[model samples]
Target: MENTYYRRIFNGCLFLVPALLLCTKNFSIGAILILLLTATWYLIKEKRNYTLDKIDWMVIIILSAYFIANIPIYLSDMETTRYFKGASRYLFIIPIYFFIRHIVTETTTPRKYLDWGIVVGAVGTIVIAIYQFYVKGMPRVDGYLYSINFGYLSCSLAFLALTLANSSHIKKILWLSFLLCCFATILTLTRGAIFAIPILIIFSVIFQSKQNKCKNIFKTILIMLVFFWGMYAYSAQFKERINFTVTEFHRILSGDVADAESSGGRIQLWYAATQSFIKSPLIGQTYAQREETIRQLYQEGKISDWPISVKRAHAHNQYFEMLASNGVLGIFAIIALIFTPLCFFLKHISKSTHALTGFVFVLGFSIFCLTEVPLEQNLISSFYGFVLAVLINFTRNDLDNIQDSET
Candidate 1:
């Protein structure tokens, strides 16, 4: 009876994880911490042996590799530890995953809470973004986090809402949440987030069509196209962002890197990071070494003045950042981190809605990583860890149920 009561409380608390994620850093962290502590208490009191499957072990190993790859650099230079600070969140995923599985039972539908949380998060993001952009007259709506993180996170939530809409009874509400999230993403004017729209639409169509007939697919696509077209036409910010991306690429291709803005700057950072990787491909360059390499490139005029003036440490690209900082091992770890879960979700996607959501989330992050180092930020990493844990737990439950029914 006591255990059941505690479980109910734990399940209720799960809603806060996604609900508060976009609104405040501390509340989300606090919610996760509460769940973690409660789960730990139960684990200690019950003294039950929990088994981790192959995929679980693989997740642990991949997350560990991220931290271990940075150890060599830390040993060589202590000051470089800060660069890998966010890597600690990867390690926390191990405990988070275990505890979620421990508390979320077969009888309890945890996804209900999580789905509610996603809707709340979508609403919260839209409200915050609207206030920031319209009332404050800010060029970009960042919300609680910076513009890029806010945008990509909103995009992720949008995808999740769309996925839930597939099987949800309240399809209209979920669809509305999806639109709200898309609007928030547009408000931020994040090119990477905007780039994810077609991917989301593609995945939505693919998954939704599997459950329905072929004829409905074209109708779905048409509706989405019209909605996004309306968004693009109505939002001056979105159109300007698309135009700026095009102009930046044009300038870069025309051999005027210095004149280009974000795209050109990223290219310069990528070049410097590549050079650093070449020098120390095994473990990659230390933070200081990477910075020095960038400085030298700036001096030689190989890198643009704008990037040099900003003086960012890590590569703007996640892959390049890992290649430059942690070398081959770091890069491999990150790839494994993304692809391992990705493959699992892909395998079970047809059987499980959670798997579909997980697949979309992982794929979306993979896209976001192209232009930004998302895991480098603590808040973003923590959010990723918690959401991934929830999805994985529910996905495993779904797979197990399917297997049981098959037998």
Candidate 2:
């Protein structure tokens, strides 16, 4: 009965993951509160159920660096803002690995159950994202599913769908669902995402390749491209974005584009971040400190007024954003935090191959994050948190296999 009660709480929390995601949309104080509460409840009642491995410590190390990046909290009001801003983003780290360890170590649930739940939920998200992107038309707020800032969530979901499909014998319904999801991804008109989708698919093909897998995968790709183009060929924005991408490629080849520079308005942000880094050099201007940093620089006539009001809330690049907000220490911490999941997954991938697919899925997300503040936005973050929580917390593979076999 006690075990069943805990499972009920766990499942209830699981359902709340999506609801809270929808409510707050991204990283939310409310969601964080709920997560912390859930963690506490488990610890207080089911004390023996709790376990955190080295991965948790690694996350702590990065987060500690981030916290240290801000000092004199009482001296400045913005210090609190910086703490929460960095902390909330970092908080997901707790739920992720800790939750996964708890699930895996508990040893009651079958591994296949977890896998199937992930497959079904992932496919469901793909379906909704597809309807939002391709058939129903893009939402005005999103410009595509989950907002324009990190709209690539749709593509990432499609990638997950494709990977799950690969792990099983192809069925007509599943294959058709995969193809529809693929078409939905392309409709978003997110250029980097368009390129990234193929990279993930190609990665899965290469990783899982067999004598016949390559041929079937290529055929699948061809069909996907044809169907996607057939549905959304009339979108001018998509065409223009592709053309701009081609132009950028040509510029790169001709030496017109500079590294850490130029692509939309990124070079400008990178330049500003660099200049800011130069002045502070140690502890950054702090998260809330950026506008003042700008104001001071602007008053001194060092930078133009035009560059001051950026649409990007933070520095456009994640690494540079940390540098701008928290300085060098923060930058390293952010990099490690963003990077460790994939590295850990890769390191232990020999123990579990399915995790490699999850790593590939994360790879596409990391790429999207490089140029855009996808994680900064609520919808994107929440979608990720909810899905990832499910990814890590779900257990019972026999149950997972049941869903897999049914499909």
Candidate 3:
């Protein structure tokens, strides 16, 4: 009875993770602390040995790689808090995965909690977005965080809800949640998050088509097309953002860099980042060093003056950010961080909804990283660690069951 009661408490905490991740500040940290405490209690009281399997070890290694890559910055005399704090979130995945694996049982599955959390999280995003955009008249619906983070996080939640929709009994609710979350993403006017919409739709159709007939697949595509068309036709902000991107790209191609907008700014940042990488290709430069380089480039007229004036810390693109800040080692660490779990999730995507959720998340996050250094934000890093830990735990359980049966 005690074991059952403790398991229920653990599962309840899991349910609150995604549910409050976006809606409330620091809720995920509190929930993680609760889970950790419970896990520690189990460790001392039961005196049981919980060993990590190969899959768990892979997750730990990849997550740790990002943090390890940042060690040099800490060793140097620089303002390390901004760089180190976000990277430290990766370490949380280790304990989270361990405790979740140790606590979960056949009778008490984690998937349902996660699925419901996604649903609740999606609803919360829609409400917050609507209120911010419609009621408060904000330019972008940032939810509890800033615009870019909230936008991409909403995109990730949308994909999770969609992936689980096929298996869920509350299919309509889940689908509605997915569309609303997409709506929320659109309201943020984040080009990266909006760009992921069609990609996610295609993947959803490709992976989930086996469950439905060809006609249903076609119907789903048609519905999505109409929905997007409606968004384009009706939402002035969405249409303007799309058109502005095209206009900016054209200006860049025409060598009108001074008048170009966000896209052109990104090109300038990328060039600066490339130069920084060339200067310190091995271990990379500190944040202060990188900024000094940018200042020097601005004076030399090699790059524009905007990045300097704004005092932008990152290169806007995550790849460029890592390349400039952490160099070649950071590149390798980030690639492993993205693709290691991605390969694992892809292998099991067809069989497990949990794996599908994991796959969608990594893919969507990769898209976001193209335009923003999302992991630089502490909240986003924490969200990534917590969500990936839960998904990996459930997916690994499925893999283990398959291996056990084969043996």
**Predicted model with the maximum TM-score:** 1
Model 2 ranges off by over 4 Å: 12-36, 48-53, 62-83, 92-100, 103-146, 166-178, 210-234, 247-262, 287-306, 311-313, 382-407
TM-score of each: 0.93, 0.71, 0.93
Worst 10 residues of 3 by lDDT: 73-82
Local error of candidate 2 at residue 382 (angstroms): 4.9
Give candidate 1's error at residue 398 in angstroms. 0.9
Quote the positional error of residue 202 for candidate 3 in Å: 0.7
Residue 365's C-alpha lDDT in candidate 1?
90
lDDT of each: 0.80, 0.54, 0.80
TM-score of 3: 0.93
What is the alpha-carbon lDDT of model 1 when measured against the actual structure? 0.80
Q: Model 2, range 1-407, lDDT digits (tens) per residue?
A: 76555455555544444333322344333544565566656655556754555545665564455445555332344435534444455455455435444544334543333334334544554555555555766532243234444347656655555655654454344455445445545655555576677667766776666568778688759966875475447766566666767777676567554431336346556667776678676665554456666666667865556546764336667677767655676666666655765675555443344555556766877888667666555456545444443433332233344466689
